[model samples]
Target: MQQGSLARYKLYPSSLLWLDSLSQAGKDLRARCCQIQACDTDMVKGLAADAHRLLARGDASGGAIVLICLADRCRDAGELVLAREYCEEAVSHFSCYDDCRHAHNLAVTYYALGLVYQSLGLETDAIGSYDRALEAFDEARSQWMWAHECAKRMMNECDEVVRWIRELRQGLALGQPAPPLLTGTLVKIPMWSTSAGSLLRVREEPVDWVDVEVSALGLANFALLINGNSMVGLGVQNGDVVLVQETADWPADGQIVVVRMDRMESESVLKRFYRRQDHICLEPANERYPFLIVLPNWRLKEEVSRRYAQSHPERGLEFFLESSVHCVGWYCGKVG
Candidate 1:
């Protein structure tokens, strides 16, 4: 296709969304679909010809598989625009079907699409594509994973691919400097946290949950990811995963713990817990940062309110500090 002619199909501006294809789900399916297995230039050219023939013959599934294989290669070779074009055409023919094979194909296509966006530095869009991939993989795994011989052979790899996507999505959310690839041998743990001061609901899935390898300290009930240098004094560095043991009781003097203050149930923060004769302190690990000290009375809140009243009167009436500090969990140790 010529450059001027390419602009006619306007779905892709700066050339996005052309990728579509299937993973090597089963040997039988590929054999049945023109046998264009490898990504070599000659092979891909032949595959393109076969893809057209298959589509002309009304074999939508086979055609999509070939297009996606081509897309996958284009992605690998840094031909992102071409990759998306192949994927888009693949999408035009097939998205999903009741059959498990179609679902597997859809999953692979979505994964490839995610890679395109990820390489383009579009983290949010890449995450969305991976989400779609997970959905398709879920459907495929439920009934087809072990049923067909070819599908069975590909199950483990499919699962690992999904896990890898999850890892990528999460690391991006946390702004991880480097995301480690954990082998299958390690136990995966569900995390309930927010880095620094954000909110993540416990009921929902991980776009937040992180995994860690169990150490001599034993397995933590939950985990949190350190996102900033604020916790450096506590030996928790950026990108480190902090394992926490869930506990109702507040930490004894000088112990580190996770806590939610002022009725912010969804948002949790980590601090050094200490108790005094009259007040309790949720001390920040770094002294340079502000300390969260619960004063003996409403003096702290009153002083701030008095200053604010000179400018805004309405908010002063509405503002009330609720010091209901709820302990979330005890910090176990750091794991990266």
Candidate 2:
């Protein structure tokens, strides 16, 4: 298309071709989409040191779309605030076009905003935003079915959130924290030495509950119990203890890890990490599990290491004892 004709469509200003049908134009758009995906992948892998770069090449509308995409990426990457900001930007993008497209975008944006608000502890505002998003979706009729469907899902989520909010409110009114149902020692305790002697109890209290400080072990602040022998060589076996850390930071190279997959209640054994300048490689001790590399610098390795060292002086030996230390933390034998 001619330069003057291109402006007539008012499509993305940066995109030379406005139509999506042309093969070359499709290729260009796909390429731009790929660029957005690449940036999102980096954000997901926690290498998003400069988020602005993701929007630099795109036009205003393109930037808004990219930001929305990046918000999803950030959510997956565990960067909640950044994700929220991106969603907000997407909402701000269609201020002039307050038609169906605007309503659809606002619905999606507000849904995302609600999620971020809920995560950030703004429950009331989250619910309100979710309600507004639902209303926006209702108003965006006959515009975009996909966006409408997304709004429907968000509306359903509101029901769940409302239940949670009500439960929380009841707790607050009662001046008590919501009681955990399965209360007796929700954590796994590992024995000090694996010599088959009487297991040592790390906690001196009457042991009604086992509290493990997971973050102190160079892992995320969470723990999981391994129910299989898939991770045997790494001292994790069936019924063995596994600890997981969940933070925005990525794992270092060749460190043992626990990853909660797409559909599993228990987080499975991820592999030891292998660090690189650009990415961190996960290598499972058992060859059955394939190794994969993710963008590096997801986790604060040095900080985790220093914290782990301060917490467990004896366990620090593993760093020097093994060719590579993938995991650092105290593990105890799991008992009823």
TM-scores for candidates 1 onward, in order: 0.39, 0.32
lDDT of 2 at 121: 64
Q: Residues 127-195, candidate 2: write the lDDT tens digits.
A: 677677657656654454455545454444334333444454455445554333111212333322111
Q: RMSD to native for every prediction?
A: 22.5, 18.3
Report backbone clashes per prediction: 8, 22
lDDT of 1: 0.56
Please report the candidate that would top lDDT against the real structure. 1
lDDT of each: 0.56, 0.41
Model 1 regions lying over 4 Å from their true place: 1-49, 145-155, 176-336
**Candidate number with greatest TM-score:** 1
